[model samples]
Target: EGTVYRQIPDLIFEADYKDRWIELQEAADPWKCTLPGELQEQMKPFQRLLFLKQIKEEKLITMLINFIQESLGQVFTEPPLFNLNEAFQDSTCTTPLIFVLSAGADPM
Candidate 1:
């Protein structure tokens, strides 16, 4: 049998930090209206905080879909134009639109 062991993150080993993380998790609502200080600091390097700060639960799905579509149209795809009239020409068809992206190009 092959077994693998991994070192745990230092945060989990510290009693105070572990307790604080648990407390934060318990207190946070479903949408995470407020994030813990440590997590906020970690996200800063990746600019995740900047993006997350403006998020609203109600519009999150629409915003994500729009972001993906916009990124595909602007960055990943060539000839960035989507003809809505052409796409919906057949009202009876229920075929979903799928994108065939090039290698290393992810709209998300």
Candidate 2:
């Protein structure tokens, strides 16, 4: 039989990294939050569990674009209007607004 395993990620991204997930995990209070007292006393095993995570769209977009803009200033800065309008894209630009992440399964 195949065994169940938990795959924990080293780094996770979110709109507010330190503020959200960490705070929520702390508040979970697994010690205080429990099954029935009797159920907790008994040892049980052999159940399968899975947690698949996907990106939060807006947050991920904001995070990545912030990174890009910081790295490369004026992404589409094409100067000189010497009949080269085709090669030159508008200097004006907007920060990246769309981000996509794919979620997948892992076997253990």
Candidate 3:
């Protein structure tokens, strides 16, 4: 007999991290109201931090997706065959298996 398995990942979010992101958004909002030249110097560090964080997240996601694809490619290189009689005849044969994995809205 063939068996199917569904896998869901455990995701954890920190309250402090969420709060810090809100704070950054609040601090950056004022720059939009002020003149570019007046606030450019003051906002440079915040802008830089946000940009670097975005780049890091993008790279991490890309790496994760690549890793998952490579692993799956290796695992499922051959299509599985399901035969009840053959499985019984061959002592080495075990149950056939299938895995279904899903990701969330964010690629992680």
Candidate 4:
């Protein structure tokens, strides 16, 4: 009589592989339907539940567009032109004015 070892069935290995794949998917997209902690806490319970469900069902880009349009309406308005020379005239002014321009757009 020699040593006898139990061999694991291939099906068991396949099932374990599937389980690990599912776990990896869950780990990868942990924030799929989550809101920032403060915003979630501020929402009413029933509204929060519905919003969570709806956001999961909705296309992310669509939700982002709606949020930007509804929450940041002022961004669509024309920005006020600044008189840079007058703004920097104060000797005590230590703040820097930064310009964000599009490609090929001259700052001057």
Candidate 5:
């Protein structure tokens, strides 16, 4: 329905708990496999897809928030966490629903 964070379960298996950039980047070519050539060259401006995906990863995200908070000082509280609905509204968005999991099965 919305922008799919991912389709392949393996890519998402531990993502909610741990960081996955180093792993996914290393999974293939690390440089080109996940991204296209232009984005690799542009450095600042990125492709929409990569931008969306980047907003979702935790490590990259925290770094972004830290950068903003560090620069903005007391005004900013935290960095943004990737919420399908929130990215548009919340600017200094950290402390998102993350690093968590649910267990056991419920009969469907």
Candidate 6:
């Protein structure tokens, strides 16, 4: 006979909690703006795919960071004096993937 293992139960939050949180979010950003239709129409198929890919990648990185912090009880820090040129030049070193979280608009 095979041994049976019990599955872990999922977390359950209060009823209406999700709805109330969503309402608060909508109230905070009532505009609920999105990419302009004109700009979206102008984007090529590849461009649209690339944009979606970038968003998915951002979400993935955030989840990974959160998981690491929760499991290890420590936040990961960016390495100091990270030289892109040197990293790329090394044959043994794997190229690191970089995601731009934010960038300030250039002054006119």
Q: Residue-wise lDDT of candidate 3 within 1-108, one digit each (tens)?
A: 011101101101444345544543444332223222222334344343344344354444433443444546544444588675765665543554443457655423
CA displacement after TM-score superposition, residue 20 of candidate 1 (Å): 1.3
Model 5 regions more than 4 Å off? 1-36, 43-56, 65-108
lDDT of 2 by residue, 37-105 (tens): 222234232111111112233243333444344445446333545443533453335633333446674
TM-score on alpha carbons, each prediction = 0.26, 0.20, 0.18, 0.23, 0.21, 0.23
Give the Å error, residue 11, model 3: 24
Writing each residue's lDDT as its tens digit, candidate 4 over 1-108 gives 011111213423465455643443344332233433233345544344345344344444444444545556646543778887876774354766666899999977
Q: List the residue pairs that clash in candidate 3.
A: none
Model 4: residue 4 alpha-carbon error in angstroms: 83
Per-residue lDDT, model 3, residue 62, is: 39
Colliding residue pairs in candidate 5: 79-93, 79-94, 80-93
Please report the candidate that would top TM-score against the real structure: 1
When summed lDDT is taken over every stretch of 10 residues in candidate 4, the lowest stretch is 1-10
Candidate 3 weakest lDDT stretch, 10 residues: 1-10
**What ranges in model 4 sit over 4 Å off?**
1-76, 90-93
lDDT of 1 at 77: 35
Can you give the lDDT of residue 18 in candidate 5? 35
lDDT of 1 by residue, 1-108 (tens): 111112124544666566655654453231343333354434432233234334344545544444445445435433568776776774444676666899999777
Global lDDT scores for all candidate models: 0.45, 0.32, 0.38, 0.45, 0.42, 0.39
Indicate the residue-level lDDT of 9 in model 1.
Answer: 47
User: How close to the true structure is residue 77 of candidate 2, measured as C-alpha lDDT?
Assistant: 38
Candidate 1: give the clashing pairs. Answer: none
